[model samples]
Target: MFKRLAKCIAFANIKGGTGKTTTCINIAGYLAKSGNKVLVVDFDPQANATSGLGIDGTTIEYSMYDAFLNQCQGYDGIPITKIVLETSVENIHLVPSSLNLGVASMLLQGTRDKTGILKRIIEPVKSFYDYILIDVPSDTGLFMLNSLRAAEQIVIPLDPSIFSLEALEYLKTYCRDIEEMSDHVINQITVVLNRAIISNSTQNSSGKPSPSEEIESRLKELPDPVFVVPQSLLIYRSQQEGLPISHYATNTGKIGKAYEAIATHLSGNSNVVTIPEREAEYAS
Candidate 1:
């Protein structure tokens, strides 16, 4: 069962370009729009989530690096509250990432508790929000390990591609290893199928099963509930405009509604919302 405090979820996939940052931004946005206090930690060195939310990571005074170093040294180098910045989206905040975060990970490797540093950094401030989403990088290094350690739940954004399907298996194995290592059970794991093409025909031009069909079949075999976000040009446009799909487009639209459904699920409203059935059919 999830703790009564803020729910910390990490959007993690060891494959890049699977829309991890995009998922983090939109879900946090919609959740905040729904009147929940949300904080997005741009844990990825790429800082895409920071930039996607209309914040210039380069200009941020204090990034995750400061917080990590502070925790490692046991000195109040900088509080996470100071590092957090408000976004244009009301009720949403961010701890912007920096290029220095890559260097910090290297430095963290020498620390006694590298994997637990992020958890330490987050412990102080997690209770301040309703949801805290960490956008993790696409690597299995100490940085990714720290992210996994800090988060209570995982949200994996997967593209409907053959490579993504394989990556999902690898991620599951990785999570099992983490659970054994840390003795912390990740209570919930939700997979979102992004950039999916919905069609009545199961097969595509090559006559093999379409990506969505294959993904759905594979996901059903697992215990996790999967939600599908259809392929749409609105996503790109929203990114370009520095706004979330829920903000740039109407929440009732295909793309916006898909993310809204995800937000509802993440907000512990699973009893109030049927995510897999409603989103899958909407995508179709």
Candidate 2:
């Protein structure tokens, strides 16, 4: 079981352009709006989380990179709040990422056990927030492993395309690896199909590929996803505006509605999981 944990979830996938950063922002935003104190850690070197919240990425002196190295070298634990910058929303804060983060995997390998770096660094800060959402890079590498090890669960966003199936297959293998590391009990990874057509059910109207069905069947061999994120152009535009949909009060558009629903799902009110039999097994 994960110790010192308070609902840590990572928005991750090896492939890019799958709405990883966009999903991370909205999820953290809704959680904070629900009166839950939330921290968003940008694991990617790109610093999308920082920019998404309107923080100048270049101004961040300390990033996740420092936090990991500090732990590896036996330095004093860095207070997360020191690195976190307030967003327009009161309850949500961010641990910004740096361009230097691009080389972190290489730098981390010789420094210490890279896989558990994030896990150890985050252990102390878990109690500070009701939820900690990590926005990871869109690639399977040493860096991704560290974030996965730290996560209590995983959230994957798919763009609902043909190539996405190939990516899902790879993720299934990744889940197995995480399971093997943790005594054969895989951590829950929810797959969310983003940017999907609204009317399309499990199958597309054309039957080329019903994103819901194609992904669900592939994941059936692994774990079932919680739900699909319907296509919403407003969500994309919100990110471009450097603000959360909730903050854009005037635009009570599709993206805002979808994010609210996602927040509801993440609140753990529903019995959403791969194996219901194991739900009680993993309940904290």
Please give each candidate's TM-score: 0.89, 0.81
lDDT of 2 by residue, 1-284 (tens): 54434688888888898988888888887888889888888888888888998888777788877775566554444555567777777799888888876765555434666577777777777877888899989878776777777787788888867687788778768867876775434357677777755433454457564554465445556546545555666666777777777765666565565566667677777555342322233232
Give the range where candidate 1 is weakest over 10 consecutive residues by summed lDDT. 271-280
Error of model 2, residue 231, in angstroms: 2.7
For candidate 1, give the lDDT: 0.81
CA lDDT of every candidate = 0.81, 0.72
For every candidate structure, what is the RMSD over all alpha carbons to the true structure, in angstroms?
3.2, 6.3
Off by over 4 Å in 1: 1-4, 74-76, 200-209, 271-280
Which regions of candidate 2 are displaced past 4 Å? 1-5, 73-81, 182-186, 199-223, 271-284
What is candidate 1's CA lDDT for residue 198?
64
Clashing pairs in 2: 203-210
Judging by lDDT against the true structure, name the best candidate. 1
For model 2, give the 10-residue run with minimal summed lDDT: 275-284
Candidate 1, residue 234: how far the Cα is off, in Å: 1.5
Candidate 1 residue-wise lDDT, 97-178, digit = tens: 8877787755543468667888888887877888889999998778778778888889999998788888888988888888
